[model samples]
Target chain A: MAEEAAVGCARPTGGPVGEENQNETLQSQETLKEERSMIKVGQKAPDFIAPGYHKGAFVNVKLSDYLGKWVLLCFYPGDFTFV
Target chain B: MSIDSMFVHKMWNDHELEHMVKGGIPYPMLSDAGGKVGTVYGVYDENAGVEARGRFIIDPDGVVQGYEVLTPPVGRNVNETFRQLQAFQLVRETKGGEATPSGWRPGKKTLKPGINLVGKVWKEWKTTDAFD
Candidate 1:
């Protein structure tokens, strides 16, 4: 647990998001809201890097890392909740 | 991805998911805490602090091609997602010259997109073929 925390600590929460919203992060919360509107098909997906469980281990899931492959971003409510 | 922590995902994969699959889910189950990723996708329920069940299919170019969001109690389907992925790959390979019919599966007949093909798909492909 401590090791995992140390590994994840290197990357700040929403690190990639903050990088993507460089200008907005520097501004007020309103700017962040304005910048992060709904993402529609035919538009580029907002890139993100989040902590994830994969292959029986913890890892950073970078959306860009899966480029060149078909990606299905399956989002469900919290696990163990019938999903 | 939902707002679940990595610890919860680990537990689920090891305890519950392993029973269904040989080694649980094959893909990465992301932990998007605080619904940050969900908010961008418009599936976040701020009050709930979790994402509604959603599936976004993205192509190789990182462009979202399809998505669906349903509340809990209505689980999503992996088969449907895989079918769409295959369809998308086929369409991409053909450069939109070919289209997959409803319930299309690999090795199934594909329709060529053109004015002549319009209203004539039935002549080439029957509704029953969707199952075959």
Candidate 2:
């Protein structure tokens, strides 16, 4: 786990630390609202690097890394939930 | 992708990981506990506190070729996603000259798009033949 964290410490989306400031994050949600419209067909997908679970290890994944292949970004709720 | 932690995802998919052909899950199941990807994709329902079922098919250039977001109750069809991918790949290979018709599959007829084909698509396309 320590080694995994060391490899891909680059958190582009500020995900892991986002929960620290909920109030501030909520205020920033206003700016994020405008981003909703940008995610659409024919538009370039937003690039992100996040910790992904594969083969029992936490690995960083970048959307750009899959540039030459078809990428299926399937977003569901948390695992073991209703989804 | 889900908002679950990497640990949780590992625990959840343990069976598939251990027994799968490659000894791992077929694809990368991203952990978006912060809902970052969900927010960008507009699939996060902040009030409900969960991400809606969302699927995005991105082409080689990273452009979103097809996407769908459904309410939580509805699941997705992998076959349909694959079909769309194939259709987009075919059109991309042909450089917009060919288009897949309704329910079109590979080895099936494709429609040739042009000013002349605008109104005659229905009459020109058949399962065995393509528009001239």
Candidate 3:
């Protein structure tokens, strides 16, 4: 569980660190830190109404539709691994 | 977790859906194709046209209870969601009777209510008399 929590916490901070040299590491670290600070806990999740390809057709789904259920909204960098 | 070509292709494919369904992903995995959800979630990369790996547990009331936004390399744990859900359920059901500590499990010890009971509760954890 601790490992899992560490994985969660490390998600936002584990950008290119070891691969880079000292100078590049410092620059990348500052940029990543700035990006992380943008998302704060306790803030309202931004709502959206968009075309979702669920079941078969591209149905319009809105954030408001999930008002009564626990929505695990996750975002991956790309379809594969370029992050 | 990479979310690059392979990840995106897998997620958007029928095989991946079947795999996730078999793997017991109870919740829906909505795609942020245009990066709208990702942008709103603050995980969107404009240059790459993709979202950063991010996870948020939004309660029934639409408030975010747990939020985790990771860089691209790491994967998320499905168990933490269950743990959080359990913790939230326990607190909601029990009202203010107890509070969950870090890494709290369902049947494990919880902090008891009261003023003077604080020190005593911590000290008398081994004793059954600590709980009211």
Candidate 4:
């Protein structure tokens, strides 16, 4: 998913970090696996806090931050992988 | 949102900035590598390990008003998305007094949604209307 998301929008940062980063990402995925659920229309969308890339900087953004404004939650596969 | 890390996003932006003289990614691309965000939106293909392209329009009250998920092979049109947004806003502002017809644009005539409008849209909207 990470690779696919990358390809949908921006290219990958560099070549590859190493084993440590891979393990870390996998670990996070494992932790989130249990929380997956089907979100429904008219239901309250889940709130999330994640790092976002904007204007060449990494900013910590949260879904709650856009409370009063309409939000277009777009999800892509990876940064640089094939779409 | 994407599954790539912030580091990768930064790199992508840097590359785009260097190469593309005009226009960059306008919105903040959230990183959901853990797949948490995708899971919530139900766009994550757990086995395929990728999120099918998904677009959700959330109202100010945090409700999911509209959404669509397409296969990864296809891309979405930004102009259409913006048009949809405007339609939603227009309807909301009018307090359901009017509704945008198909191919509706800003400043165009809008239909008055009601039981009578179900089949008489063509008659209600004249040929001169932009939707026609």
**Tens digit of lDDT per residue, candidate 4, span B52-123?**
789999988888878888887678888888988899989889988988877688878788988988888888
Candidate 3 wrong stretches, greater than 4 Å: A1-37, A80-83, B1-11, B23-28, B124-132
**Order by DockQ, highest first:** 4, 2, 1, 3
- lDDT of every model, 2 decimals: 0.80, 0.76, 0.61, 0.77
Regions of candidate 2 where Cα sits further than 4 Å from its true position: A1-38, B15-24, B126-132
What are the fnat scores of the candidates, in the order listed? 0.80, 0.80, 0.58, 0.80
- Per-residue error for B87 in candidate 3, Å, reads 0.8
Show the lowest summed lDDT stretch of 10 residues, model 2 chain A: A6-15
Chain B TM-score in each of the candidates: 0.84, 0.85, 0.69, 0.82
lDDT per residue (tens digit) for residues B48-115 in model 3: 55566677877777777777776667777778778877887677678857777765767878777788
DockQ of each: 0.34, 0.35, 0.29, 0.42
TM-scores, all models, native as reference: 0.76, 0.77, 0.64, 0.74
Best by DockQ: 4
lDDT of 1 by residue, A1-83 (tens): 33444322111232232245656546756655675566899888889999988987899989999999888887877777764
- What candidate 4 gets wrong by more than 4 Å, as runs, is A1-38, A81-83, B21-23, B115-119, B126-132
Q: Can you give the lDDT of residue B54 in candidate 4?
A: 90
By lDDT, is 2 or 4 better?
Answer: 4
For model 4 the local lDDT of residue B64 reads 85
